[model samples]
Target: MAEKFTDEEFAFLRYARFGSLPERVKLEELVALNETEPAPDYSDLAYDAKERAEG
Candidate 1:
């Protein structure tokens, strides 16, 4: 089975895969912004209904 990832984890994965120095820096900026900002509600985001039903 595949593992689920958080937004931060996905960002890190992107950094590990195809990111350049600038991209890494931008990711850091995004992290900092996230830390300072209010968290977003993800209830409206798309999800796999089959996976949810299976779980």
Candidate 2:
């Protein structure tokens, strides 16, 4: 089965695939302006994947 994705996962995937740092910062700015919840922790996701592979 395909992996499930949280909102942060989708954002991180989009950022990694198509966004520069400036773009990400801009997205954050936009989210803040709109009073949206913060995106998920992509680094945590990455760490979890690495841990799964190593173990």
Candidate 3:
């Protein structure tokens, strides 16, 4: 099983995990990228062949 998170929450969680790095990513740039990028399309996610067929 898995838990789902909103776009904003996921972004924050990622930052919390990888915010510190020697590679140097600007927070503002990351924020802008997130704002411009579309969220994932999960409308077709299924558990098995039967669930997929139901769609």
Give the worst 10-residue stretch by lDDT in candidate 2.
Answer: 23-32
lDDT string for model 3 (10-35, tens) is 88998899884477777766753335
RMSD (Cα, Å) for all candidates, in order, is 18.0, 21.3, 16.5
User: Where does candidate 3 clash, by residue pair?
Assistant: none
Top candidate, metric lDDT? 2
Q: What shift in Å separates residue 45 of candidate 2 from its native position after superposition?
A: 60
Model 3 weakest 10-residue run by lDDT: 39-48
**Candidate 2 segments whose C-alpha is farther than 4 A from its true place:** 20-55
Q: Please, what are the lDDT tens digits per residue for candidate 2 over residues 1-55?
A: 9999999999999989987556234554554345788777999889999999999
TM-score of each: 0.33, 0.35, 0.33
| Candidate 1 clashes between residue pairs 3 or more apart in a chain or in different chains | none
Candidate number with greatest TM-score: 2
lDDT of 1 by residue, 1-55 (tens): 9999999999899989987455235544554333466555565333555567779
Q: Best to worst by TM-score, what's the order? A: 2, 1, 3
Q: Report the backbone clash tally of model 3.
A: 0
